[model samples]
Target: MFLLSSLLCALAGHVSAFLVETSSLTDLYPPLWKECPGQFSDYRVENGVYTINPWLYPERMGMYKILVTFTAEYFERFAPNNEANILWGLPLQHGWQYETGRLADPTDETKCGRENGNHTCISVDSWWACMNYYLSVLPFFGAIEAGVLGISSDQVQLLPPPKDQMYFCYSVTTCRSTFPETMTKWSTFFQQAMEPSKSWDDLLKYLWDAHVASIEEGRTSFDDRSLYFPKPETDFGKSWATAMNYIAAIRFETTLQNVTKFQKALPPRLLKPDDPPYFIEDFTDSQNRFLFLLHGLNKMHNDSGHKFLSLFRNLMKSELLRKMANTVLEQIILDDNISPQELDIIFSGYI
Candidate 1:
């Protein structure tokens, strides 16, 4: 009975979300938002084989674009326009990293990410970019392994940046052999996602499991990369990584619409010194408000033991509960009082 109610509510919420008419970011960022690679030929091709160096921002993003294009069918049951495709998170995150200067050369040794130099270069020196490579490149490989790419693994070659040759794999065989456990998780996700019996929840669970595993496998590899940035950016990285743990457990929606909504919570630019979570010294009022919520969520996550986890997981399945949560937040954002009766109406069932 509870499940039925939640499913109904989820359906309504999804419809309402779609009707909101959220704008897509197509050409907002120059050069970085060139074009999605519809086929292997759109990439660098030589003698019928494709060579892609993911270190270059466009090439790496192309990998994600192709993946999204291929994976859209699996998510068609959820929303129109592939707006519910779980893979949207990968490209959106990469774009955010690029926009926020997280992909730049941290040591200032080279202009790898500078406008004056190779602006779209994914700097090997940036810890954020290195960590993101695992998320982007691995899933791209897994899509091929799962037969979604329509291109054989042998037909494509992935190149690492000039220096960090040991951290990446050039082909599906190399990737599967190099990171067996991580690749297994991701491949299992893509394989299972294609199964007809998989539910929305099942897909989210599989994706989140793979996503977290990728982070676990790749995060420790760049411990020293933290030394490249000042204290503020370093602190933001720690906070952001920890925040993802909370997000992973809830299986945050990675749909195009949801991602658009989620990305709004992030600071539009690079974090500046003294721009703390609670203050608008550098960021806008809304970004700072969202930052406060992140800190609050982080605190509640730590203090509540399994309580926060349980509630978060519960909230994911129910639209009314989500509406209730949003209502409270909306009131808070408006600096008005939250009405308990309104929330009671939203949470009318499963009591």
Candidate 2:
């Protein structure tokens, strides 16, 4: 037992070390990452309207790029070289969405975002793209409102998709008028980021608060677009959204390392037509376990919502503790020999 304890400690230390020690996020990437506008000047401007097209992956990623560059100074105090920037989550998640083919046009109208077609176009017809708009645009909107974008709110304009015009709000004026609460939620995070004497934990709280608010709006925003996909993909969206509440409640460190690790645990694409524990040939054991764990968490949350999550969050308060917890979860997913019964034991009373 003593030997086993030492081995476990060593494993945990390895996990912690791997997470903390990482190169720059821009150096490592998910394809089409070569160029993003780190400056507002990279964007085309005519008549003072800085048009950013979210339907194009690079254009949307530029939004994240500008955000990271502007916010780097603030995060430098938290970690060496600012590679641990909490804002890594935004671009990281967007990269995942793109690599997974979530940015493709769902309507099959013009082949705007398929592998054989326009690979980088983020089709507004895509359910995933619409859902991601909330995450991307709201935060960018926040940064603009907070004066981090170096342009007044009116100067920047989002070019919407040709269709589904009513589903989205384009400019700072329109989005603020439409989704006021969600807009303010993201704006507050940016506001908090600019203030002095803020810690990483404080920023994580603000980011997660705004993140959940964006997810809430996304859940409702794409009723029609979500129908373009089959039932399983749509259900996966629900499960993923449900699981996020737990993550947000925990304020799971959105730092560079954790987000990279977290991205690893996600499905390469949208949830396959086959559900987990049933074996999709394309999915690895880790992906299967991830889906299983997500489903289990979502089920328990529906059974008993929000009560134990606060406790779980408290339990995972420290950064080291959160890293260790993520390591254990990754180990569980990697353990193919482990059965449903064992997973149940692990999730028991997790609510």
Which one is best on lDDT? 2
- lDDT comparing candidate 1 with the true structure: 0.74
Q: lDDT of each model, Cα atoms only?
A: 0.74, 0.78
lDDT string, candidate 2, 164-203, tens digits: 7888888898989988998998898888888878777788
Off by over 4 Å in 2: 1-25, 274-278, 305-351
Candidate 1 Cα errors over 4 Å, as ranges: 1-31, 296-351
User: What TM-score goes with each of the models?
Assistant: 0.78, 0.83
TM-score of the candidate numbered 2?
0.83
Model 2 misses residue 63 by how many Å? Answer: 0.5
